[model samples]
Target chain A: DAGVTQSPTHLIKTRGQQVTLRCSPKSGHDTVSWYQQALGQGPQFIFQYYEEEERQRGNFPDRFSGHQFPNYSSELNVNALLLGDSALYLCASSLATGQGWFLGEQFFGPGTRLTVL
Target chain B: AQRVTQPEKLLSVFKGAPVELKCNYSYSGSPELFWYVQYSRQRLQLLLRHISRESIKGFTADLNKGETSFHLKKPFAQEEDSAMYYCALSPLGSGGSNYKLTFGKGTLLTVNP
Candidate 1:
């Protein structure tokens, strides 16, 4: 089975530039979430998209936003990027809501490593 | 707000030795805790969740609400066990909204052959 897939496995951009990372959820999954993982740190929650709407968000600023399409694909966009934005962007998909996650595990994509110089 | 904490930044153990990765959390409401592992060059994957009360790859975690800890433990540390581990927390009422999870700073496990 094809698991979660993310495009642009690695990206390099200058400060103040914008970057958009795409994610294809695992087959049979409908909810998508994005996270940021700094060097030597665990991934931090960014926001979650379900049914084409942002359902929940973390402590991130407005620069980070996301969209979920009808096909369950997701895109994470970061505007006015700064050097601190350089980190590994990970995408994870699960069934909508927290239901049955106790039964089926959350699938994760290989991640897009973004480097802002 | 919910948060996870992994006190150890790095943990080292010899082959055939036991391993324990500590995880703690703070939240006003009920919490769902999880342990996720990321092997070198691999994506982060769920190892186990407290609700399941199960073990994966010889690792197990028990939730102690009184202590607010969910420590991952393994009987024997294999060379393949070397990886980074993260503890996560999802708060109550996540079904409707607030589905986002909070993760800790992660612990890097190093197994010496």
Candidate 2:
């Protein structure tokens, strides 16, 4: 398995523009999560998707949205991007198992570097 | 609100010396803590999780619930061990959708030769 894979390793956008990042989960994985890591900071949870539905969401604004396809691939779409939106966007995938202790064990991708001007 | 804090932004130590990366958390309920590491030009990966009670690459972290800390430590540091380390926490059970992780800012460890 290639673990998790993200598209467009780098991106550039200006204010009010939109962007969409894609992610393909690891083989047999059923859940996908997105995170944003700003400069000099750790990854912050953006949202999580399971069964093609958003299962959990973080404190991000409404401008940030996501979708999960039947194949477990996911897309993160940002509308009206702001300068602060510049950061590394990460996608993580894991099995949605009933095992609570291991649920958060996610495998991350290389991450897409988004630069907003 | 849940939060993880890594007290040091950067830590430097010589080879064969001991090193410790401090982490403290603030969460109301039982949390699953984990240590993640990122090497240069590599993706972030899990080093260890509290529940497993295992060590990776000679690094071990003991979760102190009383102090709400999961500090990663190593007795003998090596140049290969130099990387950015992060401490993360997840709520034990939140309707089976608690996979979200709260992470610390991270500590950049530099093991000098």
Docking class of 2: medium
C-alpha lDDT values of all predictions = 0.88, 0.93
Q: For residues A43-86, could you state the per-residue lDDT of candidate 2 as single tens digits?
A: 99999998899988999999999999999999999999999999
TM-score computed on alpha carbons, candidate 1: 0.93
Provide the lowest-lDDT 10-residue window in model 2 chain A: A96-105
Question: What does candidate 2's lDDT look like per residue over B46-113, in tens digits?
Answer: 99988889989999999899998999999999999999999998888653436679999999999999
Candidate 2 steric clashes: 0
Chain B TM-score, one value per candidate, order as shown: 0.93, 0.95
- What are the per-residue Cα lDDT tens digits for candidate 1 across A35-59? 9999977888898887899877889
lDDT of 1 by residue, B3-106 (tens): 78899999999999999999999999988888888899888888888877888889999999999999999999999999999999887453432446789999
Best by lDDT: 2
Q: Which prediction has the highest DockQ against the true structure? A: 2
Itemize residue pairs with steric clashes in candidate 1. none
* True lDDT of residue A17, candidate 2: 100
The global Cα lDDT (0 to 1) of model 2 is 0.93
**What is the TM-score of each predicted model, taking all chains together?**
0.93, 0.96
